[model samples]
Target: MYAGAMKDKRSDSRLVLEKVSHSYGAVPVLNDLNLVVDPGEVVVLVGPSGCGKTTILNLLSGYIEPVSGTVRREGIIRTVYQQDGLFPWLTVSENIAIGLRSVEDPARREKELLDLIALIRLEGFEHHYPHQLSGGMRQRVELARVLAGDSDILLMDEPFSALDYQGRLRMRWELVRLLEKRPHTVVFVTHDIEEAAQLADRVLVLSNRPATISRELHIEALRPRDLTDPAVIGAMKEILKELGLQV
Candidate 1:
């Protein structure tokens, strides 16, 4: 696992949500929300199941407009959801190649796809179909597909939620390794505090419906963090407390 590199102070804010609020019909989901993600920083959102976490991602991705306030994005955004979103008929290499479709040169596109497959450690399975790979491998392909686009920001919503415990642990470490190689401003949403503690540079805790920022905690521990370490355990406890969970 790569150590958590100190974030460069010069990196600018890539995404900002200023006093943003959103609703479905008459029911509000997010209320007066404000967030800023610096370039190459990983921020995680954790809260009650329906506290507008996914709504925030939708707003950031421009899939939906905020009912009030402003949503400003400085660069291209890509999203990875809980589902892999892989094309059943396409091989791993082919699915990843979808992101490079706009590349005019066939040779250049192929080279890029090959490089991405290597980056995600899918080199051996490039020719394998989605059904042939494990769930974790499929998710890796999804991640590689997103990264292949060279997006400036990544919005991940419970991306590893469907994986088994061991798979989730492995993917968390794999994610850190991948991000170290290809950095991006990331906003990840997860219900798991341990996951948030393990991945986030900063974690934002949200309230129930009509969600608002309830608390913000920064994880100062280095990456490849040990779950048993006092710092990590302390951070997890604090986050759970914020979420009204007894530790």
Candidate 2:
């Protein structure tokens, strides 16, 4: 991963995978997969189960490296998993403060912590422990913690999959709102086509393992996309069709 802009900065690719391929022991997972995510764009990855969607995320986040090809990333990265990584012993405020531990100024740190609390709309629950909050609320704190950092890229792996149908829908809206306030280049993986339609600037459909891009759909609609809108529905249908799930 390259740091700040200087001489010999390769390109503007915020995150990139070039001719990337990986395998698990004897099993091939990804094959010559090439992707480039520009700054501030939300790219959603969708594929059948066990198609190495999360593996791609792990590659981008440097949790693992491709056995072949190159992975290049610029700027700091933070990941939000399906489950909230909140510390049960830490209060909401304290948990968020963990992200700001790098700040040397106490006053600034406290201010930023409170700002993140407000950003996640958990102002009143600042002192509450994780168990005291609902699952959705705990997830919000997880998001807030990530946002509190200076990371410019977010790798989210099925971040809302644990939520109920209604809860998932609500979190999508909340994510759009938060991103509008503090935009980050996001790579989200999900099995939900509707979620991809609602959140992605571009949706990538992957084929079954030895995963490769089957189709790439660009959603032209703006964020907070209307679910019933023709463009949104059309995109969803196109994705389903590409995945051979049109029924």
lDDT per residue as tens, model 1, 138-221? 999999988775466889999999999999999999888888777778899999998999988999999999999999999888
lDDT of 2 by residue, 40-147 (tens): 789999999999999999999999989999999997788898986888999999999988877889999988988999899898899899999998998899888877
Which 10-residue window in model 1 sums to the lowest lDDT? 1-10
Residues forming the 10-long window of minimal summed lDDT in candidate 2: 1-10
Error of 1 at 190 (Å): 0.1
Clashing pairs in 2: none
What residue pairs are clashing in model 1? none
Q: Which candidate tops lDDT?
A: 2
**TM per candidate:** 0.92, 0.94
lDDT of 2 at 126: 94
Model 2: per-residue Cα lDDT at residue 70: 100
Q: Which stretches of candidate 1 lie over 4 Å from their true place?
A: 1-13
**Judged by lDDT against the true structure, how good is candidate 2?**
0.89
RMSD of each: 2.8, 4.0
